[model samples]
Target: MKVQYFAETDTLYIEFQDLKIVETKDLDENTALDLDANGRVCAITVEHASERTDVHRLTVEGIAA
Candidate 1:
């Protein structure tokens, strides 16, 4: 998994899988979900992320090895 914040675009992208995105579904004007061919979510993109999320802070927990 990976998380990236693009300062120039104020966009936040979180990738759960390194899979080819077959389709993009808009959750709203500022949010979108990327799916693979099997229809499983591969990633999520948030526009205007600075306004909607706390981009300065990130925390991860309960990750299993």
Candidate 2:
């Protein structure tokens, strides 16, 4: 999994898998979901992320070593 933030576009992208995105579905005007061929969610994209999310703070838990 990976999380990326683009300061120039104020976009936040969270990728749960490295699968090829077959389709993109809009959850709203500023949010979108990326799905693989199997209809599994591959990633999520958020526009105007600065206003919608707290990009300054991030925490990860339950990661297996």
Candidate 3:
């Protein structure tokens, strides 16, 4: 998994895998979810990231198998 924050656009993108995104769902105007071909989540994109989320802090636990 990886996360990237775009300071200029105030956007944050969190990717779970490098798979091709087959579908996209909007959780809200500023948040969206991306899914892979099998309908599994592949990534998330948040707009207005600074105001909507704390981009400065991140915690990662044990790796997924």
Candidate 4:
């Protein structure tokens, strides 16, 4: 998993899997989810990320095998 934040667009993208997204589904005006061709979630994109999400800090838990 990975998370990316762009200062110019104020967009935050969180990738759940390493798959290429074939479709984007909008959850709302500022939130959208991405899906791969197999129907699994690929990532999530949030617009106006500076205002909508906390871009300054992030937390991750658990151990990667």
- TM-score for each of the candidates: 0.96, 0.96, 0.89, 0.88
Residue lDDT tens for model 1, 1-65: 99999999999999999999999999999999999999999999999999999998999999989
Off by over 4 Å in 2: none
CA deviation > 4 Å runs, candidate 4: none
| Candidate ranking (lDDT, best to worst) | 1, 2, 3, 4
Query: Candidates 1 and 3: which is better by lDDT?
Result: 1
> Whole-model lDDT, candidate 4?
0.92
Error of 1 at 21 (Å): 0.6
Residue-level lDDT tens digits of model 4 in 1-65: 88999999999999999998899999999999999999999999999999987798888789598
lDDT of each: 0.98, 0.97, 0.93, 0.92
Q: After superposition, how far is residue 14 of candidate 4 from its true place, in Å?
A: 0.5
User: Which scores better on TM-score, 2 or 4?
Assistant: 2
Residue pairs of candidate 4 with colliding backbone atoms: none
Error of 1 at 64 (Å): 1.7
lDDT score for candidate 1 against the true structure:
0.98
TM-score for candidate 2, please give it: 0.96
lDDT of 2 by residue, 1-65 (tens): 99999999999999999999999999999999999999999999999999999986999999988
Two-way lDDT contest, 2 vs 3, winner: 2
Residue 37 CA displacement from its true place in model 4, Å:
1.7
